[model samples]
Target chain A: MLPGGSTSVTTSMYSDGMSTSDRLIESTRELLWERGYVGTSPKAILERAGAGQGSMYHHFKGKPDLALAAIRRTAEELRASAEGALGGPGTPYERIEAYLRRERDVLRGCPIGRLTMDPDVVASDELRAPVDETIDWIRERIAGIVEEGKEQGQFAATLDGEEIAATVLATVQGGYVLARASGSPAAFDTGVRGLLSLLAPHSS
Target chain B: MLPGGSTSVTTSMYSDGMSTSDRLIESTRELLWERGYVGTSPKAILERAGAGQGSMYHHFKGKPDLALAAIRRTAEELRASAEGALGGPGTPYERIEAYLRRERDVLRGCPIGRLTMDPDVVASDELRAPVDETIDWIRERIAGIVEEGKEQGQFAATLDGEEIAATVLATVQGGYVLARASGSPAAFDTGVRGLLSLLAPHSS
Candidate 1:
């Protein structure tokens, strides 16, 4: 058997088998979500990660570098989550409905929407590119499905796929703003339901 | 007629006929658009408004008070602008279309959306209340028009006026976020067009 003290130390040092970089990234993501770019301090990140200062500095040159990693990770997770809703074997209307109905903490706002409001996040191309790309991907993905539905006669012949896709995305993001502003989830639900009703007649 | 130097100095101060408070609010509104709440300093507001420290302090107690005044001014301006679009004598569909088509510098983002993203703004009731009221007023104003449309047989029999009103407001706000994120006005146009198309059938 391994030495008890060494094994315990090993477990403490590398719990969950997350590498040093992953731990740093995870911590940065949480901090970014909580305090935003301007409010989060490096000391806070290190404290949350349970990592030493050297390890963090070694992994990332500075806050900007750490933020880039976090933004990319968030983008990827958003895309994957969306794909899970949009890629199933169903009519385009079904897919759209499923995506809209996906559970969300409306009060917290969309992670991507939060970034749009951030001056620091919007000022840097390094931070904004992932956000732009992720949203573009989502809109394109939805538009493609809508286009497919149009070709298959699942939607009205006059439906504008690209425009509808933009509307769908806008409704959800805008819904979050309304919910946050009113301090209630009802506004968000109302917006989503309105969008769904708009799509209902087109569903086969 | 008055003493030359003293008259000149007093005239210079009142030349524009704008009050110091007005100047301060205008300056804070622009700064809030650019720097958000945390990034904007009291000094920045004073300098931008060309008001001296003594004048600023004499007019307002402190930053929060100044910000509250600025926020209220912004709310009033926003309501006035929206009323220009929503209060006109037209079909509900026409009024909404006019509101949506109201020329906007879409990439700059909405003033209220910018405030919602600000942690400091969200934390203070004095700051948040005007934002809440302004958005609520816009939605209610639009909903009132929609209800009128229903009475006039301009909307489909089954349409939900409140839901559609929320959707319309959310779309515009979300469109701003999307456009700002992508650095393009295309998303905003697409969202507006899609909503207009949705409303078209009801117009007849």
Candidate 2:
């Protein structure tokens, strides 16, 4: 589980009261984050979730089917979390800054971004679709904010909204790699600070 | 193999001309890039390199031992490649631009960066050392250049070189993730362009 994740919620989730299906998905999501698809197996999923083989088969067809549900849920959660700051009242740059500064498991990496490195996930169109769509949606949402910034003259008229948005996304996704590779959140913070300074030079 | 990689050189490397140790290292490097540590096995490496099991065992203790050699070689190669452009005849910004615009196998992603996502790679400090050192070296090199740029008044005096260098590295490493996720090099290109524009607004 992620650092600071609610232990109470986790305990409640795995209790007998929770449905087997929900337990299976929650476990899959956690396992998938820690281990890529190739490293994860049905037995491991069942073991982590405390579900029996029969219960797993009853809930989903197989590993791939269960993985899809987990991936989709993760993607949805990412979108919701980003939207919490993105949709809040602020200038475009401020909103972007908020999104970048939001608390993250720096060493753990972005769940959706990590999938790109997973051979199984990249090989399957069905598996890759949600990952692709999630990235596209995030880019588009940031682009929309950038466009608004340009309209308000907060950014130079010549700046390309979509392109800048893409850069912001890249900085973030890349920051996780930097953090994880070095085993330090300092790497992530450095990138974020540098980008913010670039975006709002005189202010900083 | 990468686009434009010397076919004859590759054939020669795989042929009887290449020594068993060389073949083992080369094969390990290729497999590590494609399958990562968890997905790669000694059996698969031997088969790919066309070496016998005895030869692999003779050359290295095990998969982990072989991976260290491959990773060190890769780190050296990455440094040499970056130095080619970074140390070339141009301004600091120009050198950075050249480095960013260098031809890459976009869909394949960064071999070093990819390892950061591998659970086995992250868990083993022995395996992760080269990756960590390589990234640190690259960032330091970039910071040196950014410092030179600031000294030359090419960038704002208030800019932080190390921080900006980290951001540059993140944009690149993250760009690879974005490109792989979307199955398009366009994402990568957009990021590069966006960052370049930010660096030199007048030029763009």
Candidate 3:
């Protein structure tokens, strides 16, 4: 795993009461985040989930099927987490600020964003769908907020909702890359600070 | 290779007269970008370069050594490419604009930025040195330009050089993630356009 990465999340996810199928899914999510689709192996998944060799096949068709489940679950979680801030009680700019300021596992990188870098994930349309949809969803959601901000004058009249939204999304996705490259979250924070300043209802 | 990636670069680098060591390094660079460090293997490198198996062993100490040389070359090239725009005749804002607008193989992503996602590359200090140094070097170089902009009143007085510099780098890095996710370069363009607007220097 990368520094400050998924070991505890993987370990704590398991409960004796958790169903075998749930274990399998959770384990896949963790493994996919840490190692990616190409680096993740069937043996590794089974070992991490603490499932019997045959348990995976017993629950799902195979690796790709199980991966789809994990990815969907991850996408849903990302959307929910993002909505918590984007949909919260605040002005458009403030709500957008809330989303940007929300905490993340910076050094370990974004779970869904990491899929974009995975050769196997990007190669399979089935796999890439959830990742692509979720990013679009987030961008669109943020664009909606920006649109609100533009109407209310928090943002400049010249700002394009889609463009500003894309910039907001890129700052985050790229912030993780910078943080991981240096093994520090400081760079990520600095980027966010700069972005917030730009979006600070000040004219440019 | 990716849909629009390194085959031509690799093919064009090799000629009958080129030394075995140079072929190995160039091939390593291409493979590393396409498959990353873990996915890249010695056999694959040789096949890509059309060099003998013995040629690798005869040239560098091992895969790690060759990777180091390849990464350093890549870093050097990235810095040189960046400086071409950054050091050109323009105001700080325009020079920074020149750097961001420079043509890139958008889908393939930034080669140096891609390495930060590699498990083997980030895990090894030796392999990661050049990648880390290059990103920092770029951030600092950009920061210097931002400082100049602040001094010349091209950017707002409140803007910090380091923070805005990190934002600039993050947008490019994150833009790649977004582009690769959608399998389109449009998101990257949108993000850059938004940034330029924010940096337009008119006021707040």
Candidate 4:
């Protein structure tokens, strides 16, 4: 509704109840994931969104502006979904396990994590911020839970929360790489189970 | 040399001692790491290699052909470097620690692992074989070490060799993602150290 949708009545852009801007953002997100920033063209976004030629110009300043919006949207969604497990009802290890075991499109890879490999995204400060912040936020959030686990005597007293949190984050981001390389999620699954095994409390 | 570099001249391609084919392959490897398969153009490869228009044509069939050669080179280099540690003198855990602690260009990420994220590479079986094989070989190699440790009574017999191997691979791959996203190598180092801590042998 915010993207000046009122100007286009003769040639509608929206496919359904969603606004023109919303469709554009969604389309851009998908393209960014599949084709990356350099390969994702303005024409592709318009065609994918089913919007007319000038619809993109009306909705956003340009590709960068639109891409920024899409990236932020993706970042927010990832954080929220991760919180579903991290902030859920369970012990710290159990919550971490749940996050690891949560459903994912492993083959498609992490939409945000993959962006780091895109030189265009990594080179631009604006483009890189969301990816950096999201990964950092996840690490910090995980560290907090790990700290709670330590404080409650649920984990080894020597386990460094920040370090363990980084391991968890890397396991997930790297899991996608392994899974994608092999054309199977088995690597990702085994990695998670292995980390869980290592994190399991020792019996006295 | 295998690419018919002998035919090249004043329309010259070589900058120094290296043959035109070697330069082309080397250039393709760097570009693929920096720009990815889809973003890396033939023109870019030629320019970086300091070769003439017909240089790439003579050396390799085309972009895909050159890319395959480059990918194989990178894969082979990676395996050799990893083997330096995995096959080194140490206990099973010590050898693994050596591999994890090996110096790497963390911010640049793993050259072979990054290829998996390239849609073009993932889509092509010929282009993808080296990446898949390299990853599988490393995983299997690590699993063998884990199995070795279990056999020697150095590790708990219950540990799954394959699962732990996957965890090691994921940590390195995902560690790159974290390091690049944050614009520093600290995350990568922390993740490795964290894993080492977890893997430190228990004192009886």
Candidate 5:
């Protein structure tokens, strides 16, 4: 409804029957994923969403506000994706492996992980809380599973759940960095495989 | 020598009798580290370096050319730093631990790893080469030590050197992402500790 031109040309759902605010937030999410917070701009969001400047101001305070909405959405989505695997039926190791092997655009990198590289995201508490919460949520979830694994004797009883959880999280996030840096998914796969090898019992 | 401001006014090492090329490359490196390739601009580089706009174009073709020079320098510096620890005296695990525990600006993140998040850097082959090569070089270096550990009976002979090396690299790179996201170095230390635990033999 709020548009420079008709919504027919723009591929994004921004100009659809959706609320102007929702459209802006969705557009911001995509931009943030591709260009990050520092690289994304207000004009680009408007252009990509086919929404005009007035609509953006009317819906949200500014770029940062819209970005917050987008970032929160991304965090929720990430948690959902992770939960799908972590909460699925399996041993702790299997669940962890499933989460690690979840379909990912290796070259694109993690949306949350990529944000950490953005100075603006780290500089603002308002912007950083969702990221911090999401990471903590994941670490806690993985730690719970790891503890369960230890209790079941699936893992070494002496294993530290929180530390193992942190390592697992690190492997995935760092895999994206390595993959993107090399412009190949091989580096990511290698990292994951290496971690798995270390995780397995010596007999396995 | 080429500048629009008095040498004393500028804080960087621009007018310290350094060659224009060196000044340009150094300025580009610092800017790239802080702002990334897309966020950094030629004008900003010149201003920061206290070099004239004319000198930038005269010394290099454009941003990409200057960026390549800067990226190569960063790659070299990173290699040197890694060598200092990886090539130092110790058992393979000890050397690996030293490299992982080396002093770093945990909040600032890895200079090369940060570049992978930049769309401009990933999109260009030339810009990406140094990053790719640097990662490859480090992985290879780590793998060599791991191989030595296997031969020396410090590690399981069945271990894959390249794979373990990739995992170590991932832990460090991913640790930065977690630390930056949480605004604390605790996550980084946890990741390192977890990896170390996994590497040590259960009997030991």
Candidate 6:
């Protein structure tokens, strides 16, 4: 029934298929991880997505818009992954240990960590807000668990929940940077082990 | 008189001009902090250093050569600074605190931290070794202090020296990343304060 088309409206809708917006976002994520913000180009994004110039322009204003969407999506994935581990039932120590020991592609490096290194990415609030929110959310979530542990008499009475939480997060992130710089996972393991040992006496 | 030159060889020897190699290395360090390895260009280095094309090429073969020199210089500087702080006289705990509370331009981020974010820099051993050495040196230095504290009966007998040292380095490096990401110095202060509190009981 569509004008100048032989197919029915439903068929035409099915034929139009893949959403250009989704394709653009997926392409942006991959490129951003591989090349970072300053290295990625609009042309590269369009080509990788297999979407024409007009289709991309129609879906997103430009590269920055597409990048913001990509960064937000990355942030969501990071939050979901952290919540999955932190929100589970366990002692605060157990939950934190699980989060640290969770299987990770250590050599590939953290996507958020990669973004932080990009000067252009960090300079823009639109790009950085999601990254900041993700880390902040993580620190707060961990701190909450530590607070509950303190109340339950699991951690030392003198323990500072917020500071310990900050220390925990900093260790993991700093571990990644150390591991990558050393070209081995030894430093990362050493750091994590060191943190775990510090928490061992506090575990229930 | 030397060969066909009018000036004596002694005249050339008396000149205090910085060698082309030294100028190139210094310029690369500044650019690396601002633009990272992937973003900085040879032309930019030469222009910034006020050295000509022939001068740069005559001293260093290419960008990689120049980068190696800069990395080594940065590593040496990091070692010297740590020694200056960690080598001072005090109770081990006091010395550690001095190192932690030492003035820093937190927002500038650690020069080595900037390198870890650069994908290309991490991929090259010639560039990454110095970064690793700098961090390892810090951890060992601090670990020795913690050990000395334990020996002096300053810290609890149960303390883990190496672990605490790892935590110290990790917190500072991680704090910089968090602060830069959030565009606030509060995160840095929070991490530092938290770390200091952890060591509070050890102070005597």
Which candidate do you rate higher for lDDT, 1 or 4? 4
- Could you tell which candidate, 1 or 2, scores higher by lDDT? 2
B58-152: candidate 1 lDDT, tens digit per residue: 98888889888888888898899999988876778899999999988787788876677676777677788998899999999988887887788
**lDDT by residue for model 2 over A1-204, one digit each (tens)?**
453223333444477887789889988888788878877778777776777668888989888999999999999999999898888888988999999999998899999999898888988899999999999999999999988988887877778988998899999999998998898899999998988888872331
TM-score to true structure, per model: 0.87, 0.93, 0.93, 0.92, 0.93, 0.85
lDDT of 6 at A130: 91
Q: Residue A46's C-alpha lDDT in candidate 2?
A: 76
Alpha-carbon local distance difference test for all models: 0.80, 0.86, 0.87, 0.88, 0.87, 0.76
RMSD of each: 7.7, 4.0, 3.0, 5.6, 4.1, 9.6
- Local accuracy of candidate 6 as per-residue lDDT tens digits, B53-159: 77777988789888988988988987888788889888888888888777777766778867887777877887888888888888899988988888888876677
Interface RMSD for model 1 amounts to 1.3
lDDT of 4 by residue, B23-52 (tens): 999878888888789888898777777788
TM-score of chain B of each: 0.86, 0.91, 0.93, 0.91, 0.91, 0.86
**Taking the tens digit of each residue's C-alpha lDDT, what string does model 5 give over A65-95?**
9999999999999999999999998888899
Candidate 3 backbone collisions, by pair: A203-B203, A203-B204
Query: Chain A of candidate 3 scores what in TM-score?
Result: 0.93
Question: Candidate 2 lDDT, tens digit per residue, B1-204?
Answer: 432222333434477878889988998898888778887878777777777768877888888899999999999999999888889989989999998989899888898999998888888899999999999999999999999998888887777988898899999999998898998999999998988888772431
User: How high is the lDDT of residue A198 in model 1?
Assistant: 68
DockQ of 1: 0.50
Return the lDDT, model 2, position A8: 36
- Residue-wise C-alpha lDDT for candidate 3, range A1-204, written one tens digit per residue: 433243434444588898989988988998788778877888878877778789999999999999999999999999999999999998998898899889888877888998888877887899999999999999999998998999988898899999999999999999988888888899999999999888898654
* Descending-lDDT candidate ranking: 4, 5, 3, 2, 1, 6
Per lDDT, the best of the predicted structures is: 4
Residue pairs clashing in model 5 are: none
Compose the digit string of candidate 6's lDDT tens values, residues A53-116. 7777798888888899999998899899999899887888889888887877765667776777
lDDT of 5: 0.87
Candidate 4 regions with alpha-carbon error over 4 angstroms: A1-14, B1-15
Q: What is the lDDT of candidate 3?
A: 0.87
